[model samples]
Target: MPKHPIAVELEAINRDGETQVVRDCGLPVQGYSVYLRAVEASGLALATWIADYDTIGPAYQLAERLSIALAIPLTVLVPEPLMPVQSGPAATTGVITMAN
Candidate 1:
């Protein structure tokens, strides 16, 4: 198999001081892809449901139902919020004064 640039190497020392090398198979995809691939590779059981970014209200409810039906774990990927950027001294100024 080809090597991945971002792959991490893990070594575990047993009681006899024996070292074991661990190989990672699913480190490339994100969100649903990760769960789906893991299931397909026999590393994990079937993924009944998955909640992608921006899943809210009804979407969450539906996922739960599917999870129960398929007897698989429900994966939810919460997205990060974006904050406004501040630039210059006026960025924090709530009010501006004009020269009279």
Candidate 2:
């Protein structure tokens, strides 16, 4: 059987202009994982859930709760399947943004 785990990450940029993962909160079976990060440059926390389409709602909820608790903005990134582009410009990856 496949496992659906949520991975949490807290990242920031150092003075050298390199992005670093300051904390890896590990994978949890379910529920949300929240972390406090600095408000400076490139300081943010992220939770990535890889699961079936049915779990998208829960993922959004998790992100929403984290955003509200941290008083920060939230952005959901959903990867789209690669397909043949028939015309004009290819479709760009879509994103959902929410502010708290």
lDDT of 2: 0.33
Whole-model lDDT per candidate: 0.29, 0.33
Q: Candidate 2: deviation at residue 20, Å?
A: 17
Give every collision pair in model 1.
Answer: none
Best by TM-score: 2
lDDT of 2 by residue, 1-100 (tens): 2222233222222335333322322321222223333332344443443222223345445444555554555543232211123243321222232211
| Reference-based TM-score of each model | 0.28, 0.30
Per-residue lDDT of 27 in model 1: 22
Q: Best-fitting candidate, measured by lDDT?
A: 2
Cα lDDT, model 2, residue 6 = 30
Quality of model 1 by C-alpha lDDT:
0.29
